[model samples]
Target: MKLFFRLAKYLTPYNNYVIGAAISMLIFSLCNIAMIPLIARLSEAIAQKSIFQLNLVVAMAVGIYFLRGAATYGQGYLISFASQRMLFDLRTQLFEHLNKLSFDFFQKWRTGDLISRSTNDIDNIQNGISSTVIQLLPNMLTLLGAICYLFYLNWKLSLLTLMIIPLLSLIINKFGKEMHKVSSDAQKKTSDISSILQEKVAGVQVVKSFAMEKHEIKKFKEESEKSFWLSLKQVQINVTQTPLLAFIQVLGMVAIIWYGGYQVVTGKLNPADLIAFFAGIALIADPVSRLGDTNAIVQRSLASAERIFEIIDLEPTVQDAVNAHDIEIKGEVRFNSVSFKYQEELPLVLEKVDLKANPGEIVALVGRSGAGKTTLVNLIPRFYDATEGEILIDNIPIRDSKLHSLRSQMGIVSQETILFSGTIKENIAYGKIGSSDEEIKQAAIAANAHNFIIELEDGYETVVGERGASLSGGQKQRVAIARALLRNPRILILDEATSALDTESERLVQEAMDKLMQGRTTFVIAHRLSTVQHADKIIVLDRGKIVEQGKHDELLSKSGIYKMLYEMQFKEPA
Candidate 1:
């Protein structure tokens, strides 16, 4: 109950519409109930051929029908307006919160699962709020009002009606709890099925290469069957809810007929009033039964609300500290005795590692995988805070500075090139928003990407596909480089940026890189040692420790880890 109210607050800004809808429906309910006695009197008047003309009664009936129609329309419009507004705000808030979550959150959740919550779950809630929730209010209110009017006409009949209606709520409340559990499970199963389907579609190439089509089909069939049964069970239970409520409604009518028939024989009730009472009760019963049937829709929406709230409630893993100052970087980075682990109680990725990146210098980290080269560079701009020790920019600890200002001074290009669906110019300008077109062109030229851009029919206006799949590996890498160059930051990070390219592509990329790195402080992580041979200093890492650091020739002359690695590579037969 509280959860329902909590979710309802999303629509509070549209309270005026909600109130209007309720008022209109209330008027409609009263009008429908009022017609009972009037219809009864009209029947008597017709039979008796009284002094009163028939035209007055017929006009009132016509007027009541018109007013009821108008009120129902008002109710529908107001409820729909409020529900749509609520849905828009809910989706917008959820999306905005997702943006605030750290990268780790996205690393753990699937694309398909998030899509389900944003689209499917929201749809369920919209229907619940607009139709089911509002419809329930009118149905219940009309029932109460009709019962009260029935008793006012005659208490003996009304008492029987009151007894019958409580059973409906009791049965619904009892089964509805179990129904919610089943419905929630069914929704989760549906999401699982969606995930499996999404994966198969996305990885059709892998399935074909491995010849696992038969296995995938069998797995999906099994999952689909499980979902099918749960849905069937839910619907079966839902089908029973209304008939049982209808049975109770019939009992009330039976009680009224028996008691009212006795009153007519005893001269305690008039025939016209008895007829009016039955008409009003019958009108109220149908919406009541349908409202009970709407239980399934309401329960399903509650399930969706829980899932959406789970994401919206998650506290961000990373946020700026209070009173944090803007980062004042002069391109001097120092990692002082820094130790880091992704999780507590786990061994450190970098153990008390220390290094300094001076202004206008390129520092290269070279090692085998798991040597923590990438992790070491990641700590410089505080992508993740060190578990121990301190990372400082311009000699001030990173934790004391605002994260946005700290990250603003550095640019990173990873091994994977991610270009969204946009034109080349828009993609480049994303590095520094509002960057001029001339600046964008110059950045592309500096990265050696301008010639390839102009080669396409649209040049800078060419729309890149998702993850830049439309472009060659070299082309995507250069576009990424061009994006970074457009930023013109105080610090730059190249995390194996040229690792995936062929020799020719690597040559072109390295040449473009040399132009970009003329004066900026840079950190380069590479497995191919030749790419970083001209670096001002090369630091060779082994098991998270800096084993060696010097110029290429100097390190080779030491006969240490760096010397051994280079010598072994040359001696190996191709």
Candidate 2:
């Protein structure tokens, strides 16, 4: 009930439509009650064999039904319009909230699960809302009106009929609890199925290469079978409740008829009033049955709402401070005893990492995998805040600056380049949206990408397939560089950008990278020793700590860890 009300708050903004729907429903219910008196009059007219009275009652019934039909149409249309608008706002709000979350939030959640929450779970909520408002509310109103009419006909019989209310309530409450638990489990299983589909689809090439197609299909079927059983269980619960409630209502109706007939024969109730009383009972029966179905829908919706609110209620671990403001950077970066761990239970990925890079200097990081090279660069962008210590850019604490302001002044080109599905021109301009064509072309030229882009069949307008599948490895790298060049940041991070390219492609990309590094504070995470040989400073890391730092030649002369790494990489064949 509390969750239902929480979901109802979304309807506040569309209250006018809700009010319209409510008024129409009220009229519809009133019309239903009005029919009871007409049923009494029709019975009296038939017993008297009065033709004129019968004709009048028949005409009034047609008029009342016409008005009821109009009310039904208005309620359906208005409520549907309001509900759809609410869904639109809710979906948009969820998407925007997702954008505000920190990097760790994405790391902690599965892509498929998040997708399910945004799409399938929200759809469930929609169904719940529509069912609660459209079916449940009207049925409840009709039931209430019918009960009042039944009491007006004979208070004693109405009281007797009401005896079953407690039993019905108990049944609804018991089955509703079961439905909620089953629905929650079903939603989770659905998320698991979505996760498997997303993971397998995204890694189709790997699966095919490993000849694991049969294995993946088997896994998918196992999940599907679980989902199928859960769905069947929910149906079993729903179907069981409907029949049980219907049987109880049928028992009540039988008692009402037997007692009401006794009253008629004893002259305690008129034939017309007895007829009207049965009509009222019939009206309430249908509403009660439909309400049972609505209960199941509401329970399922609440389950979905719980999952959605779990995400909506999360406070981002990283957000702009109250006084944080934007600042233009000049590329002077300082790391003062900075340390970080992904989570409280995890070991530190970076520790006591004090470093400085003056404007226009190139600092290269070299280490084995898992040595914290990427973690060090990631810190500069504030992807994750340091667990301890402070980082400064342009002499200002980065925590005091807005995230967009700090990151906008930096560019990153990684070994695995990511390009969205879009035109070459659009992808290049993505670094700086609304950029003029001339600016995009200039950036591409600077990155050595303009020639290849033009040589393509559609020139700049050619759509790059998903993740730039249509482009070659070197082509994608150059396009990524062009995007960075367009941003024209004061600070740059290049994570072995040319490592995957062939010799000729590497030379072209390296030349473009050199141009990108000029007059910018650059951090390079290198695998090949030859690439970073000319760096202004070389930092060697081991186990999350900087073991050595100096100019490349100076570190080589010292014969420390840097020299050892250099010797190992450039060593001759044994």
Candidate 3:
């Protein structure tokens, strides 16, 4: 019930449509009740054998039914309008909230589960509001009006009909709890199926390389079977409920008919009134049965709502501070006693790190894998805040600066280049939106990409497939460099940016990178020792601690970790 109220607030903006729907529903219910009394009039007219009276009853019936049809149409149209508008607004709000969430929040959730919540779960809530809530209002009104008319016709018979209410309520309440439990499980199984599909589709190449197509097919079938069984269970529950409810209502109807007939034969009630009472009972039964179905729908909707709100209620781990403000950077970055761990209980990935990079200087980080080199550079961009100590940019603590302001002044090019599905020009301009065509061409030329781009069939208009699958690894890397150059950032970080390229591609990319590094504070993480031999400062790390820092010659004279790594890489073939 609480969740329902929370979801209802989204409908407030469309209250006018809801109100219009309700008004139409009320009129529709009244028309149904008005027919009951007319049923009695028709019975009297037939017994009297008068043509004028019969004609009058028939005319009134036609008019009432015509009005009922109009009301039904109005309610259906207005309710649909309100529900669709609400769906659009709610889905947009969810997407915007997702964008505000921190990186770690994404780490904790699977892509398919989040996608299910955003799409299927939201659809459930919309159906609950439109079909269940909208129909519930008219059904309740019709049931109530019909019962009142039954009492007016014969109070004794009305009390007998009301006897089944308590039993019916108990049955619905019991079944509703079971429905909710099953529905929650069913939704989870559906999410699992979605996860399997998403994972397999994205890794199709990996599956094919390992000759695991049959294995993947078997895995997908297992999840599909689980979902199928759960769906079947839900069907079983629904079928049982409708029949059980109908049987109970039938028992009540039998008793009412027997007692009403006895009264008519005893001269205690008129035949026409008894006939009208029966009509009222029939009208009430329809709403009662429909309300039972609505209860089941409400339970299923609540299950879906719970999943959606689970995400909506979370607070992002990273957000702007109260006094954080934007600042233009000059790229003098410093880390003082900085330490970081992904989580509180986990061992630290970086520990007591201290380093400084002056403007326009190149600093290189070298070490074995997991030596905290990448983690150290990651702190400079505030991807994850340090678990201890502070970092400063240009003498101002980075924590004091707005995230957008801090990150916008830095550019990154990683080994695995990621490009969205779009044209070549659009992907290049993504680094700086709304950039002019001339600026794009200049950046591409500087990165050695303009020549190949022009040779393509569509030149700048050539479409890059998903993740730039249409381009070679070196080509993608050059495009990435071009994008970074276009930004002209004050700080640059390159993580193995040229490590994957062939010799010729490496020479071209390294040349472009040299042009990009001009007058910007640069941090390069490279495993190839020869590339960083001339760096202004080479920092060697081992097990989350900096082991050495100096120019290439100075580090060699020390005969330390850097010297050993260089000898191993440049060692003669055995």
430 Cα displacement, candidate 2 (Å) = 1.5
Instruction: State which candidate, 1 or 3, has the greater lDDT.
Output: 3
List candidate 1 segments past 4 Å from native.
Answer: 50-53, 572-574
- Best-first order by lDDT: 2, 3, 1
- Could you give candidate 3's per-residue lDDT for residues 305-396 as a string of tens digits? 99988888887777778999998899899999988898989998888989999998899999999999878887887777889999999999
Q: lDDT of each structure?
A: 0.85, 0.92, 0.89
Between candidates 2 and 3, the TM-score winner: 2
How much RMSD separates candidate 3 from the native structure?
Answer: 1.9
Q: In model 1, what are the clashing residue pairs, if there are any?
A: none
lDDT tens digits, residue span 298-329, model 1: 88888988989999999777777887999667
Pairs of residues clashing in candidate 3: none
Model 1 residue 255 CA deviation in Å: 2.7
Clash tally, candidates in order = 0, 0, 0
Report the lDDT tens digits of candidate 2 across residue range 169-277.
Answer: 9999999999999999999999999999999988999999999999999999999999999999999998999999999998988999999999999999988899999
Error of 2 at 548 (Å): 1.3
